[model samples]
Target: MQQLRISIPKPCTQNWADLSPAEKGRYCSSCQKEVIDFRGWTADELQDWFANSNGRVCGRLSQKQLDYFKPKEVRHEGWSFSAKVLLASSLALLTSSKVYSNTFAKSDSAIHQNTNEKGSKIKEEAKPSDSLIIIKGIITAKEDKLPLPDVSIFLKNSSVSGSTGDNGRFTLQVKATPGQKLLLEFKCLGYATKELEITPESVAQELELEMAFSDEGLTMGAVVVSYRRYPLHKRIWNFIKSPFVKHR
Candidate 1:
């Protein structure tokens, strides 16, 4: 009979959790030189290491260690019916709110624009028509044809009055209807008073008035002396008694 010899593999003495990091490193160097210690590795790190090592057993790992370091499959479930309904409702509410806000803003802008247009229209309708006529003229001396200042121009039946400026120009604005007759009176201290009658057609053109010097100084003095006496009867008697008293 022939003698036979056989070699048997040794049972693993240290598990992944049983050995400290330094002891595992020494053991890996002595036994499996290519094995890496994956005791403190995260799931992602283990998975990456396993993938890089082509799923080769790196070292002796217990079942607990394997389970702890195994990468869990991420089972993503599609949106549930209730979740989809909630999302759709929220989106619809947000869209409706935005639409409502935009519509309200546009309506407010249109309302303001319409109100402004109506206000402008009302103002236009309420505006008054122009009825005033402007009368402008110049005063001058009749003899020398030179401009005269401080001449008074007044309307006969109206309170409108104006005086000539230094340039002998006068302006009067009065309200008058079409085809109405306007009476203007011009007077000065040493000049004879003059009157002018104008229609609207004539007022559209500028006017120039010449005034002649008057000799009413003596006549005015005689009139003043006649009124010196107060009573009406006495004034009349004195005027009769001394008609020539002023000449003397």
Candidate 2:
């Protein structure tokens, strides 16, 4: 049903009428304004055209088929010749484009991973304040039957906080404040802070400060000192005063 006008060399017309039905289907002579009879074109028809033309079909041939049709002298117009060259060049570029795309994608992925690792290492090596501490314990009433795992453990007055780990465990670290009271606040999401007053003395040893779930949980326990006390500000001042300290 598709119709196209073909300008064949006048010398070609002598052999053109002998073209198979399929070839005739692709072209029609305008001289008599009559339809050239050729059967429906398909793979076999195309192959016959190539064979009968002594393997000289050019533009309609696929890239793989072009080697058979290479001419001793160019018969197609200059513009048509340029168009074929451009098409072949374009196909070659397209075939290799994936390699470049894949190379770029791999490079980008490596850079992203390296960046994440470098950022993580910087964060980990910076200071103890940003570090984490993992702890496991039961949140229980002195004489209660069931224990709760979802306790809200927080540093006093700060929004930075954590919840109990699975199996009633939790971990967090605040900036090392030597003299400042490090309050151990164990409050079930709906419960209250079983405030255990920690001085420098009692920080190291495993502790069990008994507290109630009710308001009556407030109680002052016996002092237990485990680690020697040194104020953080004093340490920083000493580091600054030392002649060995390098200035940036």
Candidate 3:
């Protein structure tokens, strides 16, 4: 029986793992014994070789070798323009979910209490006169100049309260006795709360409250709120537009 022989190409010292079992017993011509040559080059080595040769030489695998090991072309479903747009939009929405969710959570907690004071104060002497307090304000967003709806208003220790309608307007009536202090709490979904202290003088006149949102809430979406009070001229302008506003 004749012994099998294998040939080693010049300037190539690496062994290929994808060889047939019979070819594994190849001998190097430079060294006269049956030996397996193994000095496998990595992708980096190939790139370096090409770079050093100015794209002239291949380190271990030639273009022919590469072609031999090249992968077959795979058929894939083509994506339409709309599909691509939808995919990109979905990815954007997913990435922004955390931002939106955090804003919502903070807004929800904005009107909440930090600590509790369980009991109410007893009526004190030297009480001042009791007067009707009228409070009104526009609830505006902080970012995009949009209106917030369904804002709740609470007057501490009193049954007087109200809410902002769809256009972010609210009105409330409150009464105060001399030497008495009152706390007002304002709340809205996805917005920060507003708290105000009321005195007897403020009770007889109309008062405007400005609400500011938490910093985190302002980052997620369009916030279009102005501070509760507008300038005198601005109020007049708004009033002129009131007829149009009322029709809506």
Candidate 4:
């Protein structure tokens, strides 16, 4: 008997859509050699296979499947790369504006506080000293104990003077140094003038004064007197004869 030899048929290269389901699962020498399948497979399966098989997948895919899995070129809205940059810049500007506004507000508050402090300091420096003593008192009639209005109250031998108010109260400011003696005089119509000595220790206290009525009235009658002198020649003859003639 002669030796027999049979040749196996090679698998046909067909698209995934043209392969029958039974043929799609069958092993092919070409696919086994290539280490990949050319049959029906989902996009997910292809992606998974590609990942696991070092970027290998089915060589043939259906047109519909390819179209479904194809990456579409997305059309961006009006916002582009430059628009994004502009938007980010705008946000940054707004944030800086808020920060600057807060800074300005704090600075303004500090400036106002400093101004007030300076004003207070200036006022303190400009304030008058306590050496200027205030003398306040009431003037009244000694006989009637009634308030005397328009009574002149003044420092003795000084031009500074104050008049009593309707309430008979008078206030006078006098510069009295430490350990200095002060003399205040009170004068009024129909009243005897009064003087009071003020010491530094007693200057702060209010004074109460009573004035007595004057005994000498203001009205006085005028007196008239006339005198006649001898002539110069008659006075000289008299003077010359009086020495020679003795009085009888």
lDDT of each: 0.59, 0.44, 0.49, 0.57
TM-score of each: 0.36, 0.28, 0.32, 0.35
Q: Write the per-residue lDDT of candidate 1 for residues 6-72, one digit (tens) a residue.
A: 1112324333322334533323333544334333345555444444443224343323444443333
Assess the local accuracy of residue 3 in candidate 1 as a C-alpha lDDT between 0 and 100. Answer: 12
Candidate with more favorable, higher TM-score: 2 or 3:
3
Q: List runs of model 2 lying over 4 Å from the truth.
A: 1-137, 189-192, 209-248
**In candidate 3, what are the lDDT values of residues 1-248, reduced to their tens digit?**
11111112243443322222223233434333333211223344433433333212212222332332233343343447547868999999998997888798776665353222221222443345676657676766554345556778898877888988878788887666664677888875434677888765555554545555443211111111111333344445566877455211
Q: What is the Cα-based TM-score of model 4?
A: 0.35
Best by lDDT: 1
- For residue 148, give model 4's deviation from the true position in Å: 0.7
User: Model 2, range 46-83, lDDT digits (tens) per residue?
Assistant: 44443344312212222222222222232435467667
Show the colliding residue pairs in model 3.
128-178, 140-225, 141-225, 143-223, 144-223, 144-224, 145-223, 145-224, 146-224, 210-228
The reply for model 1, stretches above 4 Å from the true place, is 1-130, 218-248
- Between which residue pairs do clashes occur in model 2? 21-38, 165-169, 201-225, 201-226
lDDT of 1: 0.59
Model 1, residue pairs in steric clash: none
- Cα miss at 225, model 2 (Å)? 54
lDDT of 1 at 229: 20
lDDT of candidate model 2 versus the reference: 0.44
